[model samples]
Target: MSHIEIFDSRYARLKAVDWDFTDASQDSLASIHPYPARFIPDIPRELISGLGCDKGAVILDPFCGSGTTLLEAQRAGFESVGIDLNPIACLISSVKTKELPPEFLPVAHDVYEQAKNTFDGYVDIPTIPNLDHWFKPDVQKALSSLLTHIDEQSDVNLKNALKLALSSIIVRVSNQESDTRYAAIDNNYTANDVLESFLTACNKIHEAKKRNSVNLECSKIFNQDILSVLASDFDKPVGLVITSPPYPNAYEYWLYHKFRMWWLGFDPIQVRTFEIGARPHYQKKNGQTEEDFRKQMSSVFDLLSDVLLSGGHVCFVVGRSVIKGKIVDNAELIRNVAENHKMVLVANIEREIAATKKSFNLKYGKIKTENILIFRKD
Candidate 1:
């Protein structure tokens, strides 16, 4: 049995307050990319408030899938560091937190206009797996033309922003499965669908820039694995570590976004080798199991202990999984590992999983709840 302290008061407060931000328009930066199992920004906002870190204190998200935590930290006037192994994750995080001038919108509009003017020009498409299966020939040409125009831009921020806009639309216009699911082809869209989606995404960038703050200290996003980077990455002490780690065999971000990666000129095959907790790791033939996941996460906890301050707060957003006909409580596992490193569990706050996210999983049963395990470093 795991010895853990349950903070009833904190759990009650969290439950009373609405975690859903349906009314609040998420920053356009977060919407720029599609990511699986991403928690709402309010989770980070509430955790940061509860932790009560100073403005200058640095916040860190070790598994920053799409920069939701980093963006929220910056908006709340705190410096943040986001580290992810996925290159696409790093790109999305960069565009989300990167400082852009007021003139960025108009310049982006000019770039779009130039792209439209030269849409007829030939484009060099990267060789990708099943390229013909996912994209219609004309759709590919349109996307390629947009990418070519995006490449012409000299400004890093603007170029990346345009690239993100393209990423936001790729899956929608593709023959691949829906945004939530991967691999299996389902629907197809015309070339106009691709163009319209790209333009709409560009408009989102404009809206996101409206809330941009020049005074917010820039956030640094790293494309390296957490184990390698958390060892000695930050010069400043990390005050709060808020993140939602990938579940065992539940999601593979690289596989889900392979088409987007191919369109963006990144090799998804390279990321697959190092991606932790992928579905294939659960196969009996692969000779990996839940124990592998526990070991990997234990390593992450040990590495994070090095950078986080002595009294720093760690809020892990995790859900329980059913493995081998038994329930695997990830929160309990993480608590046990943290206790070994002299960290005390302050709360095991359980919250209901979002209705939309509670999809059926044949192997893992169903995830109906998530635990916000709050810990204090001793």
Candidate 2:
């Protein structure tokens, strides 16, 4: 049967399953860090198993936020690659997919003790912009000391794990209201609070390590823009792609994670400048528009066409966006772009966003439902 016929046969079955995943447990390794609008693990898990792709086929996620697709692919025994421009997102993804050594917990305990004992008089705080505004004096000192101890570790994997643990707790212990909100509030954080939160985060990582038993080495994550990647960059051909591109003016990931990136020695400004569909990108005079968004997605589809093997599949989980008081059908826009690149739209399934899963505030854009568009490369 032709690919279109095959897709038509499976369309109803795909739509029959509940895509909301309301009671699904998202408290796995994905919970190690806080990321806005992350794809529930079930989405990728079902796709990887249900897509009927070859067992040896490699999966690719171009807009890999926190590596949910890569982790799911790894769990399903498929080699996967994830690409993102956010440094903190890259770090979180790398830590999630990379297996921690058996000695990680013991070593981390020592590091935590050292950070706690040496935090009183430590003086190596990095020059963060508006440090005083976000972090209290005592909290800043404690975090600096913990970072110093984390940096002293010789093992790259262990060090990165520790760094991620610290990064996970940075927002909670700071003046920032929460991970989703950028506003500052009066938070009475202490040095001991910082130390305890770090330790708690480390313990969670240890527990997550014990729970997940997968070929983590099979997943590779890159901290770079998707536009910069080419088909030749992969050693093998890509057979499947699953990703969720950001919505226009929905949320500012860079703005919310700037403090964590700053603590981890990354420049958030660069991420903000290049981040597609960011609020700032649209607010500026003569800034980006719907046409620009289409052009960018066209380039992405072009890249996917070049990289995907013949008959490979791509699934895009996208939502509608409001621009200039008009709603834009992002799913249809992407479908049009893919058709131009010789991709056949197989199915379009709509799913409601769970009440608890709504990440953005209503003032920006209310995304009640999202479309899951599946296409096959011809």
Candidate 3:
């Protein structure tokens, strides 16, 4: 079939599905951590199944927030690679995709019990800026103790899972209202809530891992910016690239997850420096512009062109951005940029954002719809 016919067939299959996923259940490993503006798992699942890739082909999600695409790729029996600048994001993605041994659950419980026993004596709190504003005194001590215990685990996978469980409960145990809201509120979380919440998160994560376990050797995650990625990073040519690059000035992932990173011993400052589409990056003075975003995307396309196999596809799910009271068509911008890098836009499908899933601030205006742009390497 001609490329046009191939595009039409794929587009039809994609357009038939309910992209909204309003009633869909998101209670899987994808929900193990709270992330800003996470696209539903169905997006990647559908793309992986519908995009006509061979089984075991490598799938890439350069902006894999919490391993949504990586997990879906593994479910569909494919090798996957995920990259993100945020260390916490990398940690969550790695933990979610890695296979846990049969002994993981027992080890996890023992770790929890030991943490509780050693809680009172633990005191290795790292200095975090404005920590008092976000975490209460008692909460800080509780978290510090949990971290000390998590750090003592010798098994890499088990330690990472424990740390993730701890990270998952940080926001809930702090003054932060929710994942989307950065402002502090009068939350009643106490020191007593830390270990209980951690255990609950750990149990849920273990169950989620059991439900969707895949071969650990098939998946890889990188903790760095997409712009810095080289073709040499992948062992094989990627057959499909699925990602949702951050919207311009819509979400500051670094700011919202700074405490979690600090708790996990990662430098949030590093993430802030490299984070693309961050609110701080678009400030009026010494700030990046839409042109800069395009340039960055152009580089991503160029990398995709280099790494993707001939005739491979790249699907980008992006939302419109309201800048200076004008709706910026990010899809078109991506289309134009991708085309310049030897990629051809095949389909542009729009899906309405579910009201409950709209997580950005009202000041930027509501992003009602997201555009799924599919492009093929020529």
How does each model score on lDDT? 0.74, 0.82, 0.80
In model 2, residue pairs whose N, Cα or C atoms come closer than 3 Å (at least 3 residues apart or on different chains), thus clashing, are none
- Which of 1 and 2 is ahead in TM-score? 2
* C-alpha TM-score for every candidate: 0.87, 0.93, 0.91
Model 3: worst 10 consecutive residues (lDDT sum): 1-10
Local accuracy of candidate 1 as per-residue lDDT tens digits, 114-143: 656666776677787878877888788888
Q: Model 3 TM-score? A: 0.91
State the lDDT of candidate 3 residue by residue for 1-378, as single tens digits.
Answer: 001122556467665666666665565776788776665787888888888665546999999988888888878878889999998888888888887766766776776677678767747778988899989988888888878777887888888888888899998998988876778898888777887898889888888888877864446788988999998988877999999999887778898788888878789898888899887887667677778889999999878988888889999988777655567788889989998887887787777666675423324657677777899886
Worst lDDT 10-window in candidate 1:
356-365
TM for candidate 2 is 0.93
Which candidate number would show the highest TM-score if scored against the true structure?
A: 2
lDDT string, candidate 2, 1-378, tens digits = 001122477555575567766666675787888888777787788777777556566899999988888888887778888899898888888888888878888887887899888876645999999999989999899999989989998988789899999999999999999887778899988999898899899899889867985764645677887778777787777899999988876668898789999998999999998898888887778877889899989989878888888888999988888877778888889989988888988887777767776423334667777777889887
In model 1, which regions exceed 4 Å deviation?
Answer: 1-30, 54-56, 181-193, 211-214, 357-364
* lDDT for position 356 in model 2: 74
Which ranking of candidates, highest TM-score first?
Answer: 2, 3, 1
lDDT of 1: 0.74
Which pairs of residues have clashing backbones in candidate 1?
none
Off by over 4 Å in 3: 1-12, 185-187, 215-218, 357-363
